[model samples]
Target: MSNWVEGQVKEIKWWTDSLFSLILNADVEPFTAGQFTKLALQVDDKRIARAYSYVNAPSDPNLEFYLINVAEGLLSPQLAKLKAGDTLMIERHATGFFTVDELPASEQLLLLSTGTAIGPYLSMLVQGDVWQKYQHVHLVHGVRCNADLSYQDKIKQLQAVYPQLIYTPVVSRESANLGLNGRVTEVIKNNRLFDLMPHCVTPSNTQFMICGNPQMVKDTTALLLDRGFTRHRRREPGNITVEQYW
Candidate 1:
């Protein structure tokens, strides 16, 4: 059977000129924190589809997704104009390789993402799965500005409730009382991820999950590998797991 499920758009909120959010009424199918579902759309009596990651955790009744608006793109262009009571389609099955399950148990877990790519990481964080498996959960999200730093309250709450969880927001374009500033890879290169930790987070005990731009993943993966982190696989376990946002 096809994995897609039919869903309706209960609401829409713009995050930035090129970013938006969607809320749907669907009992989320059972999924790991870093999985994604394909969203189907209809245009002029023809049905089409686009995949989006869940930004909300399973504990939440309403399914939420953070989206990036491609101004010239087909689905996103139409999607951005939608309002509550609008119609859409969702797949029943969700899948991805960037969840905690891909990494072996470790002392420290780093969740790295940028832009809407932070969606899956947020999903995993709110699921309460990382806290159960690791002693330290560090979430590093890179954006262009403060407005791009979505889920501010959610991240703060999670970190506060779970003292072991560390939330770090990195912005590369704008600064000035806007929290940490720099690209995710640049921060890792500049020894920033380690700076936020109360103690050193080393490759010997740290497992990383990276998402967002492919370049970000590549650079961060290269850095981690140099520090002794490995790319995990079905059989062989490694320290770094990446999900390409596109």
Candidate 2:
């Protein structure tokens, strides 16, 4: 059984053929910037629930989420059809440890994500508190095409406020004439990411937070471990934190 509260669908933003964002108006429990909450809708006799990371800052007036529309997904396709007056089920409490606060203080924080996985990082960015802990913060977002780079405008706004924030949007398939062109794992391995940064991205001075496709998460984690980065844990603090989005 789940304790779910109803939230009004305040708005919807469709970014591309497969991507969209939902804004829900509800009074939610105060949550950490990078936590996620479950959204549900009744389908026939069953309640289909899915977890989505918040794109809005914890203090933002409305709850926002970025999502990918899976044609066959039980919930996402239905979610795509929602309108302003529709109601959605939001979990009473948010949950997840994929936040900057969970990592040890470091000189630089590298946030790596792909597709809608960038949602939580966006929340952390807009909250504007990560700037106080680390001198430098870098967000590397990977997508298949230029059209999929959804939040450049928002990132630009944040960069204006925090000059230390660095954003690198990577297009893996098409050459966008924008940022880098390669898988984020390859970019990090080949030293291309550091080339654009002010400081070196080493295990000693950098903490890595990775969120994205399962394959990307696995591949990236393997690469980082080989380079001496350890996975973060409750008892043993290390240089890497990861969340795999399905």
lDDT against the true structure, per candidate, is: 0.80, 0.91
| Candidate 1 residue lDDT tens string, 91-199 | 8777877677667898888888888888888888778778767888888778888888877788878878888887788988878245587788778888966788766
Clash pairs, model 2 backbone: none
For model 2, what is the error of residue 48's alpha carbon versus the real structure, in angstroms, after optimal superposition? 0.3
**What TM-score goes with each of the models?**
0.93, 0.97
Residues 1-246, model 2: lDDT tens digits: 446889999999999988999998886788999999999999998999999999999888799999999999999999999999999899979999998788898899999999999999999989987887799999999999999999878999999999989899889998856889999988988988878878877778988899999999999999999988999897998998999786
Q: For candidate 2, give the lDDT of residue 55.
A: 96
